[model samples]
Target: DQQVKQNSPSLSVQEGRISILNCDYTNSMFDYFLWYKKYPAEGPTFLISISSIKDKNEDGRFTVFLNKSAKHLSLHIVPSQPGDSAVYFCAARDIPGGGNKLTFGTGTQLKVEL
Candidate 1:
């Protein structure tokens, strides 16, 4: 069973606009959430993240929000650029389990258009 899921397989946004990617998790054990961006032929790179203690976290043009009640999270990228086009993955860490055990979503392709 996939603990995390990204309902949308792909998303397209105009350059300079906001791109929102969503994710959901079934495991209540997860406490830390992270967003990773991956380009073609490369591993995913850490983008942004949010902790269960906080509802939202922002960094520059990127922000991540977590709703514990809904077991949902989202990543928002403002003023999206062509360079931001890639597959975005949402990952959840099992705080109690420890040892860096994480569950990942399938991913959502984000395409930024000019």
Candidate 2:
């Protein structure tokens, strides 16, 4: 079974609007949660992240909310821009054998329209 899941395959939003993406995890050992944005023919770039100790974290137009009790997280983008169009992946860090590894969820494609 997949430890991380993104139920939505895609999302669309008009420019200057808000876009919301959701993610869920089944692993309680995961403490660090991150959101990455990926473009065609390119690697995913880190976006926003939140630690299990914190309920919410925000940077500029991007925000990440984590609910430890529910094992859920959500990413919110305010005033979404065209450049923001990309596949967003939710990832969690797993430290096993003293090594840190990331488990990523199936990405959610975000399209921003003018």
Candidate 3:
């Protein structure tokens, strides 16, 4: 079974609006959560992240929220722009051992319309 899941395959929003993407996880050992945005032919770029110690983290127009008790997390983008259209992936990492490894959820494609 997949430890991380993004139930929604896609979402659409008009420019200058808020876009919300949701994710869920089954692993309690995960201590770090992150959101990454990817273009069609490029690798994913890190967006926002939240640690298990915090409930929320924000950077400019992007915000990430983590609910440790529910094993859920969400990403919110305010004033979504057309350039924001891309596949968003949720990732989680446990405490490090040999290396910091991440488990990623199936991505959610977001379409921003003008």
CA lDDT scores, all candidates in order: 0.93, 0.94, 0.94
TM-score, prediction 2: 0.95
Higher-scoring candidate on TM-score, 1 or 2:
1
lDDT of 3 by residue, 10-90 (tens): 999999999999999998988898999999999999999999999999999999989888999999999899999999999
My TM-score estimates for the predictions, one after another, are 0.96, 0.95, 0.95
Highest TM-score against the true fold, candidate? 1
Write candidate 1's Cα lDDT for 51-106 as tens digits: 88999999999999999999999999998999999999999999778657778899
lDDT of 3: 0.94
Error of 3 at 103 (Å): 0.3
Task: Show the lowest summed lDDT stretch of 10 residues, model 2.
Answer: 93-102
**Candidate 3: regions farther than 4 A off:** 96-99
- The residue ranges of model 1 lying beyond 4 angstroms of the native Cα positions read none
- Report lDDT (Cα) of residue 69, candidate 2: 92
